[model samples]
Target chain A: MTRATKPMSLTVNDRQVGPVAVPEGLMMQDFLHEYLNLTGARMGCGQGICHACTVVVEEEDGTLAEMRTCIVGAHWFEGRRVRTIEGIAERDTDGAVTDLSPVQQAFIEHFSFQCGYCTPGFVIGATVLLDRLQREPVSREDLEEVITEALDKHICRCTGYIRYLEAVRDVALKTPGLVTS
Target chain B: MKKRFVVFYTAGVVLIFMFAAAVAVFFGAFQSSVVGSEVEEPLLPDERKALAERGAYVATAADCYACHTAPGGAPWAGGLPIETPFGIIYATNISPDKEHGIGEWTRAEFHRAMRDGVGKHGAPLYPAMPYVSYRKMTPEDVDAVYAYLMSREPMPVADKTNELTFPFNMRRLLRFWNLLNLPGDTFQARDDRSEQWNRGHYVVDALGHCGECHTPRNVMMGMKESAYLQGAVLEGMEAPDVTREGLLRMGFDAPSLAHFMQRGVSAQGGMTGDMFEVVHFSTQYMRQEDLDAMAAYLFDVDDIAAAEEPPPQPEPVEVSAEIAASARGTYLNLCSGCHGASGEGIPHVAVPMTTNITLRLEDPRNFLQTVLHGIPELDFPGVERMQPMPDFADKLDDQELADLATWMRARWGGQGSDVSPSDVENLRREAHD
Candidate 1:
């Protein structure tokens, strides 16, 4: 059975991108890099085994979710607001990139990345994660689950998992509503 | 046209100033070699005499503290969690605890254990203990570490069982592990090399156990004999490829490599992640001659071709705030002394709640237990002084203690599992009952 190809429209990194034409079932990883120059989202594991291609997808419900962009198909992002690591913290209140955001700043301060290959995806995925947690304060189990969910797919081989966990935890405490029950 | 020209002239001046300022900011961001150049720490005449006397350099070179004592454990009391593929294995008490520890072991037994991987009862130890690497230790160095431990205060805590899976926990199976492993031997000076190079090799390979993390592991997680120093993963951390071979792939030239070791950032590459820990523990402590030797050895060696590129890698997780939702109340209730409002705190006196070594140790159980129960007061002879880290077991219940420990670990990006209330209850019982 053949699925018909679909055309999609979306804003990526603030540019009103397209009502572009695309394959019916191309994986999101190929859709982003092959069709769009969104090189910030990488293809670490095509199968979503590694969360290299995570992107922030604004839902129709005015909510944001980090979709691996690799496992999801091209049509899934239709009419969605998709943000890559490049777009996480566009600018500070003062307008120049708020050095991209506290989360990015904390990542730098903590020496969180090693090869830097995975950093963009991690940053994007985390921003979306923190947003969700603020909507509902995370429970202890929720904390573990949320962390596992956000980072579960991202495979970091350096500094182990401690620094990353600490980075998010630090941001959470500062985040108020999200950290405290 | 005059107005436009005037604007252009003024803007040109402004742009020049801006350029100069930008250059300053950009250059300022790069680490400089400049320092006040305090007089280098001099070993006193007596200290020099002590070092020259016999085993002085060995203890210093071996850097026993990097492994055995760095965890703020009862100085030299061991019990730090050592990770292996098999499971989490706690370092045994090297303090003079006779039954539960090494208090009554004979010198010969210690020697055999260090050099031969044979214990006092003739049991072969797992290589995770680094006996394979320690075997290269000259007798003098072994004597120094031994002397240091013997002189330490006796800590009476019993050994914790290794949480290894079945075949690994079976002591007899380790014999097979050892058989496949090349027997460790004493370091022999290479006649072709300079004394410093040999010294560097001996230090990096033997006492330092640099290979334990750098050397790729076999299926069992034992250091792959063929790929020694190629770099591997440990306790969820990536051991940077220290070998010239692996370093080349990462684009580290010799001078830059030496600089990276002496200072923490690569001359060109970024200084991020566990490499900082390596800099803190070993490389930063090195003298120039040793650093040169290490650079030489690494650059001189060849890398066995491994994977085409770094394996499909993942970025560090962006943890959600929900993870800390459970931890926030506990931090407010039990923490906030050393850890501040945002969880940042004064180093040494109080740990920063976020992104610190103390918070991300191999095991927070000890850290939690110590914080709750307090550290054993120590005032060792011939040692510099430090304040005792207080314990909290007295005031907090298991749930509260668990919550605090879990909160602290989660709060500051500590990379560990949350301690269950049962774990806290068990530890509380073990400590007091």
Candidate 2:
């Protein structure tokens, strides 16, 4: 029997990558790994329960939302903009990482992850929260709840969630205009 | 002017008299049904133990604990808020506490509460107690349940106040409502039917009170007898028509239906929403024989074991190539990962859409709601388990979601692409609210 295929094209990181032919039901995680060679999103549960395979999808309104890559189809990202863990850091003209994003920096400072298998998802979650906070700033008192609501979906088994929460909280508190008193 | 004033005064007086008479008659004639056999000699210790054991099973079948127990609270201590159209009504504490529960009540009082919807003090209970269905329970079963309840150590949880709106808050009105709705006769074994069918009918209608939710309610919020088990939409969830025809159409024979009840998951997909709670609390713990009996009764058969095989799977429907192609893209993008490329769901991860009972439902409310909101991790009995399904409300727009739903229905669902963009928007709004 012949395998069914579909044409998919999407912008990843800042580069437009294919109207390429992919398997009809190829997962975004597999596409990131095999087709684009951008495999920062790790496959943990592969059932979308664990957010280890999360990536940031840029919405039509220019808002960034975190979505699980392991469960979403490659074609689902057609004509859309996506950002993987590999694209989160600042890069030079030579395409080399120059600086880590604030979320990554905060995660390092707080030592949020232990095995680091879940770090990418956490980073994406925190980044999405930060992006939302930019558009709609949360109150100082509700910042903790807001942070929990955002990062709670991503599971980190090795390290308790305290460090990750503290790191996210610090990022939200330290950032200007993210948390209003 | 003088004649007009006299006529108006006379009319007003007549109306007042009529209202008073109506109220008096309603109250005076309203009496709790006198049920149960005459008091016999007290049972011996061993007999009493056996009775209590049977009562425990009866209570489980009745699902008394699901309603009576609050989340993370003491079992049977009540205070679970049941939401109705009118308002929220808290389930009462039926524990053996003297002050807060039914500790001081006699056996007769307990029977009356179960059958007549009347409290020990002659106060009428809200029909939320489901006494209308419990009325068919045998006196022996009622006594057994009483014994089982009385045997338990009582908690000191006081009953929470009900927050019913307007005339529903008036407990006295329930007496009249009960008069109209409550069935008088108890369950009787039909000689023409096999013993298994009668037993199944007893377990389902009397003990299980399945009709309380499965049967559609009349305008007065009473279960419609004429449409028994024909399905009802309660609290926005569609309890699919479970009549013999409905069951057969949904690819359920007696064995499969029993399996579905006992295991909570079958080839027809796992129970979700309110049915999930029922399986978790009641049917999963039921005896296999009773489950078989229920299946028999539901299938309108004499012996479930001898029933024919489940209905044949339907042929995949044909749809426009464009629609199918568009839907396949969306399905791959959002659904294919867990549910599979051809909607043949991954084992233990997701249920296959090919035989999904929800897709076959004519009303797409549950199907749309499930897709938009998604089900959390469902852990059923034994090895059957399903991972959490992610909600697509934010991910897919109304039109996209509509196309996906319509496509799924056309391909696997034995129906047409009846879902519209407006349907998605309305369902999303309702779910949000």
Q: Give all TM-scores, in the order shown.
A: 0.45, 0.94
> By lDDT, who's the top model here?
2
What candidate 2 gets wrong by more than 4 Å, as runs, is A1-3, B1-21, B32-34, B37-50
Q: Please, what are the lDDT tens digits per residue for candidate 1 over residues B1-433?
A: 9999999999999999988855553333221211112213333445434544344335545555555653666765666777655688777767767876677776566776777676768666767678778888776566556655665578767667779888777665555556556453457888886665676687678866778778887886667878878666554345656665556544456666677676653223223334555565656666777777677666663221221232121122333455454454445323442345466544433434443434444355545656665543232222322234435565456766666666565545334466778877766666563
| Fnat, 2 decimals, each candidate | 0.00, 0.92
DockQ of each model against the real complex?
Answer: 0.01, 0.64
Which digits, one per residue and each the tens of the lDDT, describe model 1 over residues A26-87? 66667778888668888774544467778888776767777766546666566778887767
Quality class of the docking in candidate 2, CAPRI style: medium
Cα RMSD of predicted structure 1: 28.5
lDDT of each: 0.62, 0.86
Mind sharing the TM-score for model 2? Answer: 0.94
lDDT of 2 at B429: 83
